[model samples]
Structure formats: C-alpha cells, structure tokens
Target: MFLTVTLNAALDITYRVPRLRAHSTHRVQEVDERPGGKGVNVARVLAALGKDVTVTGFAGGATGAALRNLLAADQRERPNHARLTDAFVPISGTTRRTVAVVDASSGDTTQLNEPGPAISPAEWQAFTTAYAGLLPRTTAVALCGSLPPGVPVGAYAELVRAARAADVPVLLDTSGEALRRGIAARPDLVKPNGDELAQLTGVTVPLRAARDARRRGAAAVVASLGAEGLLAATADGAWRAAPPQTIAGNPTGAGDSAVAGLLSGLADGLDWPARLSRAVALSAATVAAPAAGEFDPSTYAAVLDRVEVAPQPHAA
Candidate 1:
C-alpha cells in the first residue's frame, strides 16, 4: 500500500467568489470542505487513480473528528474498489484548518493557512511509533507538508530513516528547514517547487538546482516549475517533462497530484521518462479540476499521451 504522512492534517475549506477585493464584503458563490494537507491531497489523487493508499498523521478535537468523518464519507462515496485508510494518530489539541479563496474572475487562489496544533512530547513519541509500525506495510511513503508546532524540523528525516529501515522508498515533499534536514537523510525522491528549489540550492536554473539538490543527498530532485514543467534529476538519469499545453483552472493542489503520480509510477515500476510523463500529465489534470486534490480523468487521459519527456544532460 502507498502511505502518506501529513504531520499537520487540516480541514480544508474552498470558497469561490466572483471577485476578491481588499476590505470589500462579497458573497461566496460556493463552499466546499474536506480533509487536506499535502499528504492527504496526494492520497486523494492516488485513490482516484485506483491505488491502494493510506493517510496518517495527527488529528485532534472537533475539527479532527469532522475531518475523519469526511474521510470515511469520501471512502464510502467512491465507486471504485480502491481503498483509502485513515490512520491518523489522535492528539490532545484541536487540528487546524486552511481556507482557499478562489477568485472566479481570474482563477487565482488565495490561501490562508493555520499552523497546526502543538504536539506534546508523548504525542510526538506516539506518532513516531505509529509511523514505524506502518512502514512495513507501505510500499512507498510520502512525507509531506509543514511540521506542526512542537515537532522538530528534523522529523521528516527521522521518518525517512524509519522507512529506509523497513526497505520502503520514501518521497519527501516539504520546504525550508524541514526539507533541508530531510534531504540529508537521502530520501528516495524529493519534490520541491521552483522557489523552494532556489532556496535550497541557491540557483534559479532548474537543472543546476536539481543537480545541487541531488548532491545534497536526495537520491533525486524533481523541481516543479509551475506552468513550465517538472525537472527531475535522478541516479538513472535526468529529464524534463511537460504537457503539450497548459490548461487553466484551480492549481491549488497540482503539486500534490504530481507527487501522487510519481509515487504511483514508482510503485508500478515505471521508468524515469514514463514516470515523469505521468507526473506532468496528472499535474495538468489537477490544474483543470474544480477543486484541490481532485483531477479530471478526461484531461488526464488526454494529456498522458501528449506529455513531452526530453532527456537532460547530467551536470558534472
């Protein structure tokens, strides 16, 4: 089974408004709520693609309960035989919530995120134990999103180590210090956006940045260049994958979809080129979807065949 870790799970709310202006009161045309966080988003995409996936992290309080209920409801609503397990560890503090304000006029998304609850020492220990216990069952594990308060920046590093110990590949997706520490653990793969890549490697050139990141101990570095494409540098080789054309929609969770594609492809034993093709196509499909963590299958199918995967020269 594919496993995803969201240290700070959240109840995500998406608000669609005709337009958003500063200090202007406007009525929201639509409202949608569900469980979210980078890992949960990835799991949603995996489940949609008919992959066996489980999401684990910490959840507490009323919002946490509500999120779990929503997850169970989502699982029940699926017609496919794919399974999605909710394995979140219970905590004492209330889980946080995030809001995505989508401006219908321009399709721009404004995100308001809340920092997750502070984890106590005992709660942290419980999460580690739970994570280690799940490692053996995971074919691959994705460590995603920002660390909750009271959790160390090196948490993902430790999680990566545990997964490695269990002989499971790990996909690390986070930014800033957490990412820096996690890369040192030499995760199987690391996906960072252009800005994060620049911050990590101090290079704006995608290929050079990816190479630098790989040298820092990540087995591979996949840099998400928004509408440009995805640049992947791995031991097998390097390649840049992009869709035939970029479609416009809500791009809120596109990165998570890309992560899902790469992980599912890896679990399926796809090569670097084919894996990147799937990742790029899934990312485009997610951009065309109505909400975060959802992708249009029609778009995915159409783009999958059209994705361009060009080999890139290895930088010395």
Candidate 2:
C-alpha cells in the first residue's frame, strides 16, 4: 500500500463566483468542501487511480471531524476496487481550513490558506511512532505539504531518511527550507514547481535549476512549469514533458495529481519517458477538473497519448 503523510491536513473549501474582483460584491455560484492538504490530495488522486492509499496525519476539533467525515464519504463514492484508509492521529488543536475562490469568467483561482493548529510535543511523538509502524508495510511513502506550527523545520528530511532506511521509495513535495533539508536526505524523487525550484537553486532557468537541485542530492527532480509542463533531471537522462494543448480550469490540485502520477509510475517500474508523460497528462487533467483532488477522467484519457516527451541534452 502507498503511505502518505500530511502533518497539516485541512478542510478544503472552494467558492465559484462569476468573477473575482477586489472591493466588489458578487454572488456565489457554488461551493465544494473536501479533505485536503498536499499529501491528502495526493492520496485522493492515487486512490481514484485504484491504488491502495493509507493517509496518516493530524486531525482534531470540529473542523477535523468534518474533514474526516468528508474523507469517509469520498471513499464510499470510489469504485469498489479503490482503497483509501485514514489513519490520522488526534491532536488537541483544531485543524485548519483553505479557501480557493475560482473566477468562472476567467477561470483563475485565488487561494486563502490558514496556518494549521499547533502540535504539541507529545502529539508529535505519537505521530512519529505511528509513522514508524506503518513504514514496514508501505510500498512507497510521500511526505507532502507545509510544516504546520510546532512541527520541526526538517520534518520531511527526517521522514525521508526513515523511508530510505526501510528501503521504500519516497517522494517529497514541499517548499522552502523543508525542501532544502529533505533533498539532502536523497529522496527517490521530488516534485517542485518553478518558483520553488528557483528558490531552492537560486537559478531562474528551469533546466539549469533542476540539474543543480539533483546535485544537492535528490535521485531525481521534476520541476512543474505550470503551462509549460514538466522539466525532469534523472540519473538515466533529462527530458521535457508537456501536454498537447493548454487546459484551463481550477489548477489547485494539478501539482498533487502530478505527484500521484509520478509515484504510481515509480511503483509500476515505468521508464522515465513513460512516467513523465503520465505526470504531465495527469496534471493537465487535474486542471480540467472543477476542484482540487479531482480529475476529469475523460480529459486524462484523451490527453495521455497526445502528451509530448522530448529528451534534453545532459549537462556536460
């Protein structure tokens, strides 16, 4: 089973408005609430792809309860072959919420995120202990998202080492210092967007920056370039993957879906080109969906074959 860790799980609420404008009132068209947080989003995408995913994270208070309830409902709606198990640990502090306002006119999204609840030392210990127990049975683990209050700055780094010790493939998806530290632990793969990659490597160019990131110690690095698609640096080779056409929709969980595609590809022993194609297609498909953690299957199937994967000249 795939194991996903989301230390700061959230209740994702999305608002659809005719158009989002500052200092103006507009009627809301629709609202969607679901379990979120980066790892949770990845797990949802993986489970939707018929993979067995067990999600572990912190959940507490009323908001936490609601998130768990919605997570359960989502599981029930999945196909019979799909498995999504929640193994969230209880915390004293209330869980956080994230708001995504989508402009139906322009199809742009504005996000408002809350800092997660503070986790106590005891709670942190409980989580690590539980994480250790789960590692033995896990096929692969993804440590995702931001570090909430009271969690260590090097949290993902620690988890990456543990996964490595257990000989399980690990994929890290985070930003800033957490990402810097995690990369040093030498994860199997890391998915960072353009901005995050630039910040990590101090290079604005995607290819140069991705190569620099790989030097810092990731086995492979895939930099998500939004509309430009993905730039990847791996031991075998470097390649650029892009969709046939740009898709417009809610781009909220597109990155997370890309992570799912990469993780699923790793587990299936696919080659770099095949994996990059899947990642690009999944990310584009997520953009066609109305909400985070959801993808339009038809979009995914239609775009899969059309994705372009071209090799790049390796750095001398």
Most TM-score-accurate candidate: 1
Candidate 2 runs further than 4 Å off: 18-29
Model 1 score (lDDT): 0.92
lDDT of 2 by residue, 178-214 (tens): 9999999999998999999999999998999999999
**Would you estimate the TM-scores of all the predictions?**
0.97, 0.96
lDDT of 1 by residue, 66-175 (tens): 89999999989886837999999999999999998989898788899998899998999999999888888889999999999999889988998888889999999999
lDDT of 2 at 178: 95
